[model samples]
Target: MRTFWGLMRAYWFSDRWREAWTLTIVIAVLTTLLSKAGVWLALMIGELTYSINFYHDAANTSPLRTTLTSGVLVIVLFVLKDAVIAGTRSLVSATLHRKWRGWLNSQFNEALLDGNHTHFHAQHGSADSGAAAPDNIDQRIQESIKGMTGGAIGLAMGLLGVATSLYFVGENLLQTSVEVKGLEFLGSYGSSVLALLAVATYVPINTWIAVRLGKAMERLNVRLQQAEGSYRSELTTFLRRSFHVAASRAEDVQKTMHNRLYGDIDRTWARLIVVTVGYNAFEAVHNFLGYRIIAYAPGLVSFIHNKLDLKGYVTGAEMINQLIGQCSWLIHVMPDIATLRANSQRVTELANAIENVQQPQEFYSQSGRSDFHYASQNPVFGLTIQKLELAHQGEDATPFLSAANLRFRRGEWTFLRGESGCGKTSLIKAINGLWPYGRGTIVFPDGVKSFYAAQEVKLPQVSLKQLVCLPGSEQDYGDAQVASALHKAGLGDFIEHMADESREGKIWDQMLSGGQKQKLVVARIVLQQPGLLFLDEATGALDPDGKIAFHQAIKDNCPDVTVISIMHEAVAPRSASGDEFYHSVVAIADGVATKKPLVPNLPRELTTILTQPRPVEDKWMRFSRRLKQK
Candidate 1:
């Protein structure tokens, strides 16, 4: 309960709280007005019916005209009431929906992307073993925000309407009386007391049922979201890697997707059915008891019979009794309230996850590097790693990199080389502040811009120009400069295609090959002109000559940029003639790193002469020669 209210308070007191509160108040006011108008309309109809049945003959012609006038007035009031209700609801709901979605998206992005906290992507996991980490964060930001905001607004408006109904209906019932066997059973105040008792009894039971169903719903919703996300992720992967899957003839992808949908989704749906069935069964009983209460009560039946005997055919007491029944709106809104609670819990859970990911101390601490801090005010240029030690995530005792110290100076190109799984990528992550399971201090120059090109490139579904100028706008670079960069990266063919104007807004992913995609990523780096560039097998798909060309292009385009590359033996520079390409090489073996100058190559004759063993003289001949000389 505290958590539920906490979520509401956070949203209602947020930066846009004023707008949210204003909309809420307007909706509430509109709902109250509509409810009152509805009750008035109902009363006017009842009065007309009473007059037509009981007083039609005694009334003068003027009374009939008055009734006709009242009917016309009621029609106008009804139309106006509905119009205002619909208008206010539409305006408030649409505004709130948009506001909530924007706020949630900002919060999620800040938590995940800001401050180099991308490690959260690797660390996040669900408590339930059956479920995976919350990968459908985009879905959550869209669906959960919409569901929570709409549910909360609807629940609030429904409660307001119910309150208004009760006030007018209860007041009307209190002004009338019913009698049984010449004895008055329920006067105005007595009927009010009985209604209050009925409400008191109904609220607790309704709340209990709602609470139970809400808890079950929250759990099932989490699982359902996980299952749905997993299924969708699989489908997306299959689509993205369709060519690879076909070439490799891998059947497991299909089988895994099947299991995710049939196995995980089926289990969640089955549980949902059980909870829904139980809730509905109890709801039916609760409704049955509420309607039967007036009939089964000791004095109520006699009261109704006596009212039936009076006024010839229709009775005023019967009308009042029916009006009092409008109080059931309070009971009927329980399901909506429960839905609101469940959705609020889901949104709260996601917010908490973001909060947890932002706080690194909850998982690990960087104790050795406590004294080291990046000073944004007086940032240094280049990269520095001091006393760095990183352990694999969730394994404190087993170190991945131990006590490694390295440095890459400004405007220098350093190659990071190691066998697979030897922590080269981990070192890059540590340097970039993405991996927090390490004790390290990585110092970067003040106001230094850095770009990391990963092994697998991710291109946005935007135009070719926008894709190249990403993290900035196309307006930041001239079309000529963009074309030049693309030409240098071997994507000159795309320039004409991009210049066609018709293809300006088209997605270019499907049109580009694997090598072309890598080249495009290089083009982005050239356009970004970062002071520091980290490449993790960024040109893995490109041929040797293509790799060399792209590396040369970086140096050519951005002369002073520091390049730190993770490369295999095939891609690392092989000849002393190309030694200018790299300043040094840092090799990782086991859990240790060693730095060496980039020798590139030695002459084959020198290598053979140095590596081959010298011939040895016989020990006896050497001893005899030494004695003779002495």
Candidate 2:
């Protein structure tokens, strides 16, 4: 109950509180009206039955006309009630649920993206699971929220109708005393609410039985939801990488995995089905007993015993049946209530994760960690690291990069070369303040922007301009400037697709080859040129000629940007004018990075282009492949 309330109560406190409260109150009022309508409906139904029975006789034809009139009246009123109910439900979904769910989703969106998207994942075994969104978060945001919200409304409205049922329908049943069999003691003393008491006891007793037997319903519901989410998540992953899977001929493997996952859902459903059938069987007996209690009442028994008016017996029995049905509402919706609880538990988990994201506590901390950085006297636009150490959180404190001091300056193309899985990216992450595992001082240039690119970029399903100026906006850049950047990144062939901003970009991410994708990222970099660039093999997909073009493109567009590249191979590149392409290399061996200088010149001019009449045909040919040479 607290979990349900925890999710529901937050909406009224949000910025949309006025609208939220207003819609809720409106719905409540409408629900009350619907309840009143239900009471009137039961009263009219009894009257309809009473009038038909009263006028019916073998000699007179008035019985047929009366039956026709009463049946038509009842059906018309029932239809109108149903129509109003439909409208009310639509209003509730459109206004109340939509706004509240949207508000809740926005809060989660903010929290999940809190740590610069470090808090967001697909329930994958990456980062801290405590901070990430729970399993099947999309469904939680869509289906679970709907289940909770709509279920709450249904329960509330149903209860209201039941309360009205007691007021109107129970009025007659309570006034009459029992005169049938052993139940005579019920009203022998005084006029008593035999119907109300019977309803209260009978419904709950059966409900208790149903609950005890079907206790596994909540657990089964939760298992089913998560299992379905797992299957959908895997299916999406398979589709995204279908080309590789097909090439590797792993279709059979994927099919087997999918079957196993689906089997889990089927098993959970099987358990749920048994519980449900048993519940309904118990409910059927409970409801039949309901009819017996009201039918045998003295009010109806006297009507028949005295040969009194048929209206009395007819109306009394009708109202009494309605009263019992209303009282037994809980048993009827028991399965829905169980599902609501399961969904509530999951939604609450998501809410807890979002809460943790907003105020993240430290995972790991060491003494004097913040005091590592100090001001440097280096006259360059780059970073300085002193005694830097690296390690993962929740692991042993033996640092990977132990007490290594290194400095990189502007006008220098430095390579961080290391063996595969040797913590090159970890050092880069430390420099950028992402990896808080190890300690050291990382001194940075003030008021300078930095950009970090990894081996893979997940291009969003968006337009061309949006993809290029991602994490930014298309309106932020000019058309000519974007076109120039595209041409510069060797994606001139893709320029024609940018004409329609509304066109989907999802296909491009899949259709583009690795080299083409790398070129697109270069286009992104050229669009938003940063002062310091960190490339963790961002150009791994590009060819040798493309790599040379990439360096030249960066030098041309981002003149002052300090490029720190982590490479596998060692290549001391020299220009036509005897200028070094890379100023130095930071070789990582024996768990420390030692700077190895390859250039004597402090700031070599990197403007040696094909326009300067380079004698080497290879250099000239590579430059010709670039847009500027064209």
Candidate 3:
């Protein structure tokens, strides 16, 4: 019950609460008045019949006027009661549906921003459970809220009607000596002698069944939801893996999933069927016994005129009105109570996860002064490691990189060279504060900002201008300035074509090649021009000539910014004579960056270049085939 009210409190204070509450009160009053009027009409009909017997063989003119008036009043009350009820339900449904949608959207956005989103995958496996959102959440918010709110309001009104009807019927019965069998207490002032026995026999039994059955149904719903999510995920995977599963022979996998899903559905439905049958049978027997107790008392009288009648029509009408109100209230509330239980469990799970404490040794400590920067004379950039460790599955730690502490200065270029899977990319991510499963303290100046590009950059389904803005606004740059930045990164062609494009930008990610995407990322760097820049193989896809040109552009545009890049084989290619065709290629082995000359006399080659084995590839493919004819 506490869980039920906690979940519903949000709606109680919403804008629609005042209007909804007003309508509920109005509907309750009308329902009670109508129930009373119905009992009066029934009593009038019985009296009119008795009057005809007393004055037979004449025109029945005296009671006709009262009968006609009671009939008209009954029709008017019934119509108004139904109309108000229907209108209140419609308004509540609309308000709850809209509120739930907004709440779910807000939760999704906060989860993404507050948590370490990229690193979360490394620790938490995947958030790809099929029961996540737009399905389970959709049902909870839409169907669940309606059931809960309506049920609460209906129950309160129903109980009020039942209590009032019981009072009036008991009071009127005490005025006569005619004894009611199931209500022997009606013979006294404070009636309870027989009414107490009937209520005590069934009230507890009914309440226990209602609560226990509702809990079981809630469990069944959760299992059914899990089955649906699993089935849908499997179907989607099958379609993506092969377009023609029938021809490619994936029948066995599909059949296996079908059998599993079918089994779950059968178990859930079977449990629900058993409970439903038991409850309805019990209710039917209970109602029958209650009516028999009342009717048999008059039949048992043995005197010549012993049968005592105190308007059986009035008693029956009142009982039926109270029964309908109680049943309606229970039926409306059953779904809400079940939904509130499930939602409460989910919220408690999330709260526990967020409140978990972190260990003291789990986080690295800061040792140096408050603002120890990378460019300071005795520069110790955060925490540097003598050796870094990583372990494979069930294996011991393997040393990835080992080196003495090295100094980094502001406005200096530092290049890391390594083969694929040699931990170069991981190092860059560690420095930029993304992947934290390593031994290092990448300390930054307290207030300085940095920009970095990983191997795979994600662009939300947004426009080109928005992608290049990078932690800032697109409106901050003029059209001419955006064009200039694109030109420097060798992506001017794409920008010119996409200038007047629609905002959707879905194909922009796929229509552009790897090199084109990297160029756009670099354009963002030129626009923001952060204090530090980190690149994880950012220019790996560009040709040898394009690589050299990109390096020159970065040096010219942002001379004061410190830049770091991971070096790979595609940096610059060389000619057969070992002279070189471009510059900036380097060879790194055993954790040292040794520069290798890839081109002849391309600025600073005499001082910065070192010797290394040349990377070989077919050279004749560089020229066009059409040139051979000329």
How many clashing residue pairs appear in each of the predictions shown? 4, 0, 1
**Model 2 residue 607 distance off true place after TM-score fit, in angstroms:** 22
Which residue runs does candidate 2 get wrong by more than 4 Å? 1-3, 56-68, 115-118, 121-133, 170-192, 291-310, 359-381, 393-397, 499-506, 572-579, 600-630
Q: Best candidate per lDDT, number?
A: 2
User: Which of candidates 1 and 2 is the stronger one according to lDDT?
Assistant: 2
Write candidate 1's Cα lDDT for 552-607 as tens digits.
78877988888889876523553324545777777776678877665436543332
Superior by lDDT: candidate 2 or candidate 3: 2
TM-score of 2: 0.83
Once model 1 is optimally superposed onto the true structure by TM-score, how far is the C-alpha of residue 607 displaced, in angstroms?
8.1
Candidate 3 local accuracy as lDDT?
0.50
Measured against the true structure, the TM-scores of the candidates, in listed sequence, are 0.81, 0.83, 0.63
lDDT computed for candidate 1: 0.65
Top TM-score hit: 2
What's model 2's overall lDDT? 0.68
How many collisions between residues are there in candidate 2? Answer: 0
Tens digits of lDDT, candidate 2, 477-571: 98787888899999887777775543344466765778887888888889898877888888788766777777777777887788789754445
- lDDT (CA) per prediction: 0.65, 0.68, 0.50
Q: List model 3 lDDT by residue over 1-630, tens digit each.
A: 124444445444556577556655565665566456544544554454445443443565656665555556555555544555445544554454454435533443354345344113222221232111223333343444444444445455556666655555444434433444444555432222333333444455666766777787677656655566556666666764554678878788778877887777788778766866665665566556544553233223311244333334334333433343343345334544555455445443332222221211122111111111122122325223233332221123344543334334566565666666766666565555443333433445444567777666656545677667756777888777777888888887757654543333535654566777777877888877776777777777777666665566666687666666775653343333343323333345555434443344543332232333233223323223334664
Which residue pairs clash within candidate 1?
379-446, 380-445, 380-446, 381-445
